[model samples]
Target: MSTWTSRAALAGAALALSACTEQETGAAAPREVVVARGAVLVAAPPGYCVDRTALRDAEEGSFALLASCASLDPNADGPSAQPAILTVTVSGRDPETTPPRAEALAAAAPEAVLATRQRGALALVHLGDGGDAVLPGGDPRHWRGATGTGGRVVALALYAPRESPLAGAAGGDLMAALAARIEARAPATVAAAPPQARSGDGLRATLARLFN
Candidate 1:
């Protein structure tokens, strides 16, 4: 038997709910869902300090926005099934390949299916299957793709279970809304540096290196 897992699955539920209500109007409705004020601080991966205030937890699931003054994971070799900075991942069993399965899953739900890319044996799907009128980078799922300034910002990812209460709820607008909340709270800039360079020798040395 094949297994499948997606970190975005939980977050995708919010998209399903939002998509259900917004399909016709193409506008997300106000949610009765009460969100806590300020961002919730969570321990981020080493070498990166995430804005916990960027986190938005709802009954559907949760979304977190991260800002790295330095690199989130300088040595992150490639995508892993495990959760890492700024990436939503899913791993499990399925007869189909990653992209096809991801496409089918997104289609079944109210998600906005974005493009798919193959990473070795895995297929990575970049989607905007949530609420929020404007994502960090405009909707990649759209035909035109991103434009101008939207091209520079990193994309905010969403996840959803193949079959869950949140799946196919709405057009995934709520998920977008959740993403918007996170984006609204994210830092304006993430400094760039050479791949092998460190922000500060001490800071780099003390930083916990993940993805071993």
Candidate 2:
């Protein structure tokens, strides 16, 4: 009707639009953590080998990749006689309610020893019985642990004994690199899936594929 009234209405519409934009920006952005070719994320430790494709394929639920590193005895004068082991675990969103998954994982891999439990967010388990330690003069060990979140959890444990120096390092390094890649790619909000009977098999297969 009146030019002044028209101007006022336009101004009000602009203000409303601005408010809506602000609201949209304030909401947390959804992020996908899986590493793709040419995707720049965090760098892995020096000399560490990585298999990005295999890691992404193994990803289950919301759990994403994280940092991984291999512990080798730097003091050994000769070729390392023990294999280095790397363990990775993913937890669901609700740690308190994730026990069933953990139990399933424990059941699937009876050799994995229970290492420790931290509230609902995390649990630690060893994969191999104490036999050959990775660290020189240390106990032979291969272990892994997991924590819970709201979504899902995944844990990966790897070992490379000293006898097979190159293979061991390669395996350990690949796992560690994959962990790093996962951490860099996945979002923190993504929780690990509950442990299922196929969880171990899937994890082992994923690792084998990565190395193979």
Candidate 3:
């Protein structure tokens, strides 16, 4: 080929590559949110938000995170029904083996215990009638689950107004669903820490907090 033609072809190829790079650089990235002691994560659900400000520190070994689906839209003018709350708690480094759902419920000294049942994939221990005020604000319902996998154990609970759609069988099913989402990424040894993948600034910061 002629020198002029070869030069022209190479220049065109370079321009095309630069354009591709620019397009990729400007593309939006996927969104993600972490939950349940950072053991479970899912793509940030649309219209759902997490409230981190009220994270409960029951003790050095225990903490809870709450997520809500409350509507933030201002245009809708109508009665605002109570929003559903999903609460997840993690209990770390407990010397005692994880307790059975029944045992945990009995230990709580609840005013009354209800029959144990499976909802979705989780067997839940009903804490008590939602009227007991075990939850803040005298909430109507509370339920608990103890899930262990890969030698890591986490106890999860959900507190909601009795009127919530997720208050009954639905709540149990939701608890089961969330529990199943826990990732078994617990490091088997100190030397086996997972390598951090380079990510965008936001993801990098989120992961730092999660893993640290």
Candidate 4:
């Protein structure tokens, strides 16, 4: 498929799967999560925590929702809590395939890419209004990054209210920071759940869950 086609396909799939939820991941520290058949280990950045109640591990892939630690745990005094909703999606990697490259992603959807930056080993793309092919209409502005983990491509996305750090130029730095800290662990057994890819009703629910 063409680059644009691949990019759209990915976004459409993610959009479709956004609404469907999953079981809690039990308690864990530093918020380390094994997901996507173990293709990715989502480690919450400082002051943030994984929302166990909002996770998906199924045939479609692994999805983790992240929020300020203070929001998830009333007792925690998250001094650095960021005003943003972060998500990580781990697309199961085929042994025969390589992780998506930074340049490749930028190239895939040029019209939407506002800026591309190389952060450590991560290449981040800042999307313009309605630009992110990953989650359209959810946020006018967002950041996206991809990296290889456990033979899979870990997709990172950040959405924040206007005037928030995650919605400005600093977004790339945040994305890179989170990317550098993420690690890959042993593949966990796939959950016996239905496909996260859902119907039109689910899509509307997803938009509400995300934008509201």
Select the stronger candidate by TM-score from 1 and 4. 4
Model 4 per-residue lDDT tens digits across residues 55-166: 6774345677776665565555546676566777666444433445567667655347888876555667777764344444345677767765554456677766666767
RMSD of 4: 9.0
| Per-model root-mean-square deviation over C-alphas | 17.8, 22.0, 20.5, 9.0
User: Model 4: residues >4 Å from true position, as ranges?
Assistant: 1-30, 131-139, 186-212
Pairs that collide in candidate 3 are 130-140
Q: Candidate 1 vs candidate 2: which has greater lDDT?
A: 2
* Selected candidate, larger lDDT, 3 vs 4: 4
Sort order, lDDT high to low: 4, 3, 2, 1
lDDT of 1 by residue, 80-117 (tens): 22211232111111112112233333343344455543
Candidate 4 clashing pairs, residues 3+ apart or interchain:
none
Highest TM-score model number: 4
Off by over 4 Å in 2: 1-49, 58-108, 112-114, 117-120, 130-140, 163-212
Q: Give a tens-digit lDDT track for model 3, residues 12-53.
A: 223322332332332322223443334434322333333333
**Alpha carbon deviation, residue 118, candidate 2 (Å):** 3.5
Error of 1 at 94 (Å): 17
User: Which one wins on lDDT?
Assistant: 4
How do the candidates rank by TM-score, highest first?
A: 4, 3, 2, 1
